[model samples]
Target: MAATGSRMGVVGGSIAGCAAAVAGIRAGAEVTVYERSDGELRGRGLGIVIPPPLHRRLVGTGYLDAAMPTAPVATRVWLTRVPGERSAREFARQPSAVTPCNWGLLWQSLRSAASGARHHRGLPVLSVGHDGDGGALVRTAGGEESYDIVVGADGHGSLTRRVLAPDLRASPAGYAVWRGTLPVDASAEHLGALQLLRTSWVTIGFPGGHGIFYLIPRGGDAGPDERLLAYAIYATPPEDAPDGAGHVRWLADEHFPQEWADIVARGEHAAMTCHPVVDLHAPVAADPPFLLAGDAAGVTRPHTASGAVKALQDALCLEEALRTSPTPAGALRRYARERTPEGARLVELGRRLGRAQVELTPDWAAMDQGSVDAWCRATLAGTSSYLYADTD
Candidate 1:
């Protein structure tokens, strides 16, 4: 694969798409990025964390900046309610090292890093194919174009994945995540609890659900006091749970912590977002010049805490493959071969964790410290480690 004069097209202009563009350029390819969104992507998303190990890897590889604004997490406290308990009881507390990130900021950094490439905004790729000579043909609403290589960084509904692996689809995991963010002032009444969680990420576990909440840097150019209370509540929706924000409120009221409930009750109509949990993986990753990256290749459960890490890693690996392989075909296949197993493992780990934490939960009231540890070990048997160490 000669680096010079190679043309590469990257679908999707979000985080993974931008990273793919960067990879293509670093490999000496002329790159073009196609983003479906018309306007500038606003920094809007719940808290996203990059584990310390993955953080170091990404920063070392120039995919992430060391100085990115992040809230350093010092502890993970798991709380549950028992029959006689007046308040949430903490049965497990572990020293946790995690860095919480605002998703929009991360995307902005990746896009800036890939500034060398030409980005085509407001264009959505409709389909993809091969040019019969190890080249890729991409069809968008505007027109069709050919490139030496095509990367599907488009999210779950990837056109490249549909062409490459039509059978692969994201399946609902029988649960949902009701997520939202609240300003620090919105949670002023819980100042004491907020102080306790200054350096801690708290997880409140119930019979069939759990909520993880932590402080995150506010989006955009936020001041020092500007912080957000990010909460993700996972639960099985009730029969009458209305769609959209109503469902978010229903789930939050039923399962989330009281602090989260209070924030939701503040009458911020657009505060919450509801998303159905889905897991999917494509059996094959690459077919010559056309390849899949990020969620297009496989979407692991957020429980693995490797969604963003895996996406960035995919682009980084693709960059290495292109730089080292003798042929473009070889590079694409090598990237796929190396990443498929890691994707499968993370998806499986997510399913396992989801089952343990949501579907088939343990009786929290009856578990002791040793029991909790044992349960975690048993449920996370194949997940490598709590911090996603094995994948690295």
Candidate 2:
């Protein structure tokens, strides 16, 4: 089991860090979070789909509002190409039971729930090493501190991972994603409650790859108004970084065909953000007393949009191992073994999906449809398993 009467230090203050702190606290360990940022972390992004089982647990634990305003259930995912290309249409219809929510809203709820935890903001970790006996030492901007256990909840570029698992490298998955949220005006035809609530859309350009757009409802009780959030991720190679002119310009000038220029033009210049699609193979265990969790251990491409899900899974699995194992080192080992399979599977799936989107000239229709079906089935199964594991 986790060493009793021990203090735990969590590095990084995002979702994974916060969740780890909470779990550690609940397991009867004193926990402290060392955050690199001095203030709150905020960003606008696409909505996140929360599995019903996980959502129920968050509600029961008071981490989410019992009756918070949420977007309509996502019953259909429409896939199409730009410029009304009839030959490029594809669709995946999900059961009417699934629900989706804004990613920002979920973060807000998690942040609020972690208000009571001890947080040291603006204190970036400089180094982490053993204290020569059983405890670990973490050097931060402020000073050095020791703890019985150290948790690396930092993101993909984790400092702890660098110190511990130096060989675990993130390889670019050959494609880059440009994502942004656009405002929906009142007169917009696609802004109906049912459409906005339950229908998620993905438009894949023929030969050029895919673009996904979805609507997420924000604000409680007041209901979604003039501001409906729309986000899209377009595929591009890693070496093709767009300049300040905007993604639309980059697409029109460098990548996209003339027919898709108008669709690219719809995005606002200031809203576009670029990110490389990257994931790491599961790392070998580096140390016995320290452990990796969340993206620090491994990452899933945004194509699956399961980065958050995998991080949450790491937290839950680590919590279980820590609670049940006979020793602290044993718990860490078990955590790694339990998590490696799922992490590797997600990595493989993400890369395959990304590859399918980027590779052109290979029977696009058959390839695209097959990918969508496989994704839907895999997502549903993963969600069910995650929810069951979390609640069990």
Candidate 3:
């Protein structure tokens, strides 16, 4: 590993930040993660699909088990469309190799890997500056610290992003997402273990949008009879600009269709969360060895569920570049070169997928099914070439 320096600071202690800290520590760096919140993050999501490359990296790093102990392996996908009062079309059992894991479990694994690294809660970064010598200076509520490199894994509304790309702004994709977790027993059809483990059930609406519901098992020791967690994301029109509360109500009242009305109605029963779907024009690469990763760089529509995978990939690629490059700046440049194109590609694919769902015309049912089939086929075939070096 290149000796850039031992002292490093990572802003944000979420999944991306934890992953970056683990990578830095493995590379012989002393890392400290600053989280704005005051407590340990108990990540609460059903599951996230991990692509082959990322899965391999996590397993190799001992962040993941050879076989998932909680969530089942997702080998197939099912897509359906609701037209009128009936099911328009359904595509089932499409072969796929993607593995989905409970988000909370994955976060725990990464947090464990980053055990030695210092994690400071309730320390929100106020500002960041880069010195003429290329070192990063971060000012947080706790005080000030200088680091050889500063990583921004904060999230979509990253303060780091605002400082770097002051002019860049997030424009709504004319839609918002409503997300929540429901009990497994909420729906009789959703009760079985096989149904709850590692499977994604998606339903496209009449307009150019869709709803996805999936399940992931909870505790590692929990039996098949244990309650499975259910999560859903529905794309709906924004109600009042980017106000989170307003969007949540809009999704609950207006956007959801009759079939899913019950789930939407249960929104009040559970914690309903909403956020506007936004993506940058392109991935922004900064100088001074600082760069944006994950949602901070760019976001893909949840229709593809590729955001988490891309973030993990970014961390892996950055780790590999730092390990092989001659200098820190060179490593950062290489990481950008490798990831930017893929990020652009995935964003484009997500847009296309969203449009295919929301903008169907005649033979809409068949068209939707065909689009779903093609997407599953392409993703499963591993046709999307990896732009980064094959370090593994």
Candidate 4:
């Protein structure tokens, strides 16, 4: 192997780090992973979606296990609440198919694939930079290690990215999202409505923002048949907004349909959290020894649903780069050239979605099928996305 003697060090051993380690191992490089958390990372359960083609590619590339559970839906149903109605008005049904998977399950698969790499648990990376000779260095409490290449998956605040683009920063989009998930068994009362989730994901739009609902698999041995109901509500918080969960219910009661409101506001969630919507893109993906992956390279709004997809693709790209390139520097350059433009594209698309769905929202009630299609075409502005079907 061309990379037989290369040494790769990965910082932040979450999904991105683990995937990077897997890429290095597959490329014949000796790898090490640093994880800040000592405990199992499978407990924080979140939901993420990816295109079916990407999912198949990951499984084929051995980044994911073929048996990992997933809940796939074919259509995206956009809904708007009618005044004094128990249900929402369907705005648009796009042929947006996706394979939604359990975040923990996806991470576990990648981590397993990366087990060949030495893993350091409970150790945080304090800093990352290049040595005088262009070898990347990772600094920790134990000491510093020099590697042929360093992969940064340290998330939105990455030390590795700082080495290349220090001036870049994440700018807020002036809204937030309430992320929550509930076991399917617990949502007995909403079973009728949930039937729609089996084949479609729904978007309930209100005056301020919108809520997207879908079903993703639960962790453990739960098969595709057993799933978790997931929802992400994006809206601006009021001055007197309640806590995360409270705020979700507050907005639902006022804006969502009676049935939809009860589904999100009354369900017992297995996990819930709030995240401020922000977008960031690094000027470059690699500066020789230091390479950034996942959020370390860019962070788009959740509206894109490409966060996990991008990380997995980054790993695949790294594997190909190292396998084909003549030298480590060549590999880094190749990976950066392929991914940098993609990061910028995703950031731009995220901002467009955020602006149309939240910031400069239109009167959803007045929008019919033709109007929705026109609005969507303008929002996309010629950018192709997996989330929307061709309306023309």
Cα distance off (Å), candidate 2, residue 265: 2.5
Which tens-of-lDDT digit does each residue in 1-392 have in candidate 4?
55677999998888889999999999999999998889978876599999999999889888899989999888988898896676778878888889999999999989999999999999998988777887988899999999999998989998888889888889988889999998887787876668889999998889889999999888876766788899999999865763457888989998998877887788888989988889999988987888899999999899999887898889999999999999999999999999999999999999999999999889988988888889989999999789885654
Work out the TM-score per prediction.
0.92, 0.81, 0.81, 0.97
Native-to-model Cα distance after best TM-score fit, residue 154 in candidate 3, in Å:
1.2
Off by over 4 Å in 3: 44-46, 65-70, 73-93, 189-200, 219-233, 238-270, 281-283, 359-392
User: Lowest-lDDT window of 10 residues in candidate 4?
Assistant: 237-246
Off by over 4 Å in 2: 1-4, 44-46, 62-69, 82-99, 186-197, 203-205, 219-227, 237-245, 248-264, 267-270, 360-392
lDDT of 4 at 176: 93
Q: Write the per-residue lDDT of candidate 3 for residues 171-260, one digit (tens) a residue.
A: 656666666665555654523323534354344343445555555555446563344444445455544465455544444344444444
Give the alpha-carbon lDDT of every model: 0.78, 0.62, 0.62, 0.88
Q: 1-392, model 1: which lDDT tens digit per residue? A: 55456898999988778888888888888999998888877555677877776778777877777667777777887776545433556788766678788787788778888999999999888888888776889888888899988989898889888878887779999888877887777678976558856878887787787878887778677863467888777777766763466665655565445654556556343256877888999887777788888888888877766777788888888899999988777888898899888888888988988998899888877776677667777887755754533222
Candidate 4: regions farther than 4 A off: 240-243
Please state the error at residue 370 of candidate 4 in Å.
Answer: 1.9
Over 4 Å off in model 1, which ranges?
82-86, 242-257, 264-270, 386-392
Cα deviation of 226 in candidate 1 (Å)? 3.4
**lDDT order of candidates, top first:** 4, 1, 3, 2
Could you list the CA RMSD of all candidates, in the order they appear?
2.5, 4.9, 4.9, 1.4
